[model samples]
Target: MTSSTHPFEQEEVMAYLDGELSANRAANVAAHLRECAECAALAEQMRDVSVRLSDWSVEPAPANLTKNLEAARAEHVVAKVRKPRGFTGRLGGKFPFLRNRWVWAAASVAALLILVLRIGLPTARQESRQSEGLQLAYTEQSRSADTPESKAVGTASDNFKVRPAPPALPASRGSSPKFSSSSADGQSNPEPTAPMIARTASVSLTVKEFAPLEASVKAIAQRHNGYIASLTSNSPQDAARTLSATLRIPSAQLESAISELKQLGRVEQESQTGEEVTKEFTDRAARMKNARATEERLLDVLRNHTGQVKDILATEQEIARVRGDIEQMEADQRSLQTRVDFATVELSVQEEYKASLQGAPTATATRLHNAAVEGYRSAIESLIGLGVWALQALPTILLWAIALFAPGRWIWKRVRRTSVSQS
Candidate 1:
């Protein structure tokens, strides 16, 4: 490797001539070739030899060379099949097509594809079926909601009636359907259609009696089978007391509750609002139905799967996600139903202001009495606190006094001696 002595070995020179050396090493060999005539001659001979080898060509292969080799291989395979010694050979002899690796790979791929289609098709079919059902349900609900007069007035309880079982459809992938058309009485039933509404009311009242107002509000809520969600009462000096509360009452009893609350005081302000939620509720129900169907299909896939671990795990993960969505949709549906069932009320009550001369004198007398009592108590507490402080600090004071007495006495003597000397 050192350029001082023999920088280039014969093999290095050959490698340089063959263009196999790294860039820097090839450059060094090229530079050395320029300086040393012997290595330069060797490199030139190598290049000439490479050129001659490149020009040299073997005679063309026989046109049937590949055919001859394949024929030989086929004969060897035929001999092995005849002997039929090992298990593979016996199988090959019995089944002549089992010898190709490409055939095995193809069969494996075909089986895998079949399994994937089996699992996938059911899910796709379920989704399509569920979507069709959802669309049908939505269309029916919309038609029903648009023509209110044609549909008879029904109560909220009627709206929650169990839907009639749908007609039986052929199950896919050999799995049984979760729903059926037969009722307990073995008769086809019809679907029930009802409107959903969420109601809210706000009322403000001015009351004469402030003390009994809060209790009356609670009693009214209890009587109506409702609860107060929130309540705030403010009573300031020389100001009327005001009470505000948010109440949740059943929609059936909302009117009664509000009427009773009005009776408790004079109604100053009252407003009621209702929102139609038939479409929203219907949409949520449709989506929830589809999710449940998808979940069922996924479960079927998981049960019948005979694939890799990753595939099984992926299927399980998808099932879990679908289940979570289904549960969330169910929760939302319940929440919407509750909103339709319950009515919210906002109530505000203000106590009537009554000017009175009677409280002034009485209040003044009570304040005077309280002030005298507090003054006496304060004097007694101050005396007791002084006594406690003396008890706590008396020992420490005495110790300091004792320690300073000798120093004080010596200073006094020195002062007296100095005064005598000055005199």
Candidate 2:
């Protein structure tokens, strides 16, 4: 009848002592404790501990605490009796007119209008002004006559003629070239420049042979007075050979060049593109002309004017800036001219693939020997691959083992201790 001989666990006895069990279970435990001397002694020890704990008491609250508690209870009751105020109600308390829905709606509308006026209107106006200015500038430049030097170099209207240059013009400060049509004699009407276009083409072809086709492509480029910009060719034993190249041809000869290139093989895909850069070219030319004019005027000032050291230095600096601008614009103009003169042709040639079926049959013995050799080689390769993989994974495996073992060991110890204690 002792606790050590009873069927119930110590936890059940403790729960009964704490009155946590149902009445029937508590009664059963009480009967068992009366019969079991060990359980009765354990219950007496727990009761003693509880009695000792009860002796420790907190001090009584002050008189002010009682007044505050009563005040808080009264305020809580008042809060429950009154209607709760939401966000709009609190906002209306701060601004009485906001209580009106019509007033709130009107204020929202005013804020939206102010936002549109402050942000949207200015942005629209700025874009409109910029567009207008660009249009006007383009129109003026297009109507202006090309400089004699530009004409010799080949105007955008012309097919980029690389002719010999004429004699240079005298740098006269007294006479400056004008952007608009205005002469000492009269304002003559200006001729419009032609539209400029940069042309490009791409052609994909399937050829019977790569070597002959490649040679023909090079010959065709040479015949057209064009050159190959780049060439890439690859040939694999198990796959079809391929050749890709970029060719630069004269814009005037672009059509004829593409036609000739298509003759090397059957054309699978072909595309031609042309981009108009008339406005851009005109803008650059106009800027260059203006810079040159500025440089001429500065040079005249340096030649004719007498000034102090600072003034001369400042004048020289301005001249240097104008000269730099002129050079940069000239380079841009040349690049644009080159693009307009030379058209790009991207060409790809693929060899038509054919599978071969001509091979001598091997003897059965030889075939068996080859198979065995191949199997052995594969097995060896597999083992080597496994070894390499293990080498690569060893560090990660070790790291994970170290990380898991410490926590695993701690948990195992804790479980073992719990098991021993329960036993």
Candidate 3:
């Protein structure tokens, strides 16, 4: 490695004979060996060592190794013949010759699928429960306008609650703007909500664009002093969303709001209903007055009466009853206020847009093309699923496939003979 020494020194000369010298350095060694008898003798000695070691040899391989590999193949063939024709077996590649095993696996899958289709799939218990819950919830919702029991609780919290009933229509009408802000409370002078027939109207529509409709609908509802009640949106075939929302706007804004909503999209469906609760309202008015009169008498007794322990307790009880009655009446008033302040309109909106499609409303050729493409995609996906399932059950499927198939059955017997004979 050093630059100072001759590369073809005697040791280098010997290394050259051993073929261990670097090519360029070996050339130098070869030249030295040629010029010096002593170095050439060293090279001769190294060559002699190599010649003596060349006599070493390894033992020959056994003749049966090929036979063993072949036997394994034959046994695999036999095993394939004996297994059951189950889907898992058909798809599994545990056995040889089941490389396209997904077919059997798919067959197995088809059995369960066939059963499902033939019998008609039963609803999942959880889904059934949820449906029942929604039905019950809807039923409950329908009945919860205002109630005598809820009104009797007698608290400020009652003002925030919604009760089951047709809300009382205020005497004033057509006073509030489409949408105008309230200071949360009446000011020096405030216009009251007008008496109007309580009603519910719902509409379903499909729009090519959703954002504009969303914004416009929201604006209209706000203009009407309404809030969105509920919403849901989803699209299975396209990257589009269907939106369903219930907007609660002031009854005064009803007509304008409906017109604006209609302008947003082509209407698919529409329905409306008006509910009358005049007699019910009248009955409540009378009951409230009676409660007030009872309460006044109780207050008088509390202020003026002095009696035994039992008498005082009895009077106190009456006072509590009257107070409860008064509280109930106040709760009813607030419920009526809410109904008078807002109206409910349920709307369902859908956007129609699919990126994969070309222009709208074409002929059957386009439909056929799209359907065929979709069908092909579905088939490929099904095959892929079957392949995966077979692969997963490969160990088990192989056992069966080998037992059932021609090559697999042949290989199976061979494997059994070999394994048994070897044992």
Pick the TM-score winner: 2
lDDT of 3 by residue, 1-423 (tens): 222544455656666676887888878777766886766676677778888888876788677888897898788765565554753353233333354557559746865674444234222322343354321111222123365522232111122222222223321222222111222332111111112245577888889887667778777766555667776666556567788888875554565677789888999998765554334444564566556655665566557656567656766787787678767765674465455445568898888766786467878999999999999999999999999998899999788876779886788999999999999
Clashes of each: 0, 0, 49
Best by lDDT: 1
The digit string of per-residue lDDT tens for model 2 on 1-423 reads 434679667778889988899999898989988888888888898889999999999899799998998898797655443423753343344445556669869857975774445333433433443454321122233333464523332233233322221113211111111122212332111112345666678999999877787789888777666678899999987789999999977655677788999988999999987777667866775566556656665677578766667767877888888788877766675576667656789999999998777577988999999999999999999999999999999999999999999999999999999999999
Q: Any runs in candidate 3 off by more than 4 Å, and if so which?
A: 1-196, 235-240, 353-423
- lDDT, candidates in the order shown: 0.67, 0.66, 0.57
Better of 1 and 2 by lDDT: 1
TM-scores, all candidates, are 0.43, 0.45, 0.39
Model 1 Cα lDDT, one tens digit per residue, 256-358: 7889999998999999877777778667655665566567656775686465687667668887887889778766755765665567899999999875544
| C-alpha positional error of residue 125 in candidate 2 after TM-score superposition, expressed in Å | 44
Candidate 1: count of backbone clashes, pairs at least 3 residues apart or interchain:
0
Candidate 1 — worst ten consecutive residues by lDDT sum?
Answer: 170-179
Q: Give the TM-score of candidate 3.
A: 0.39
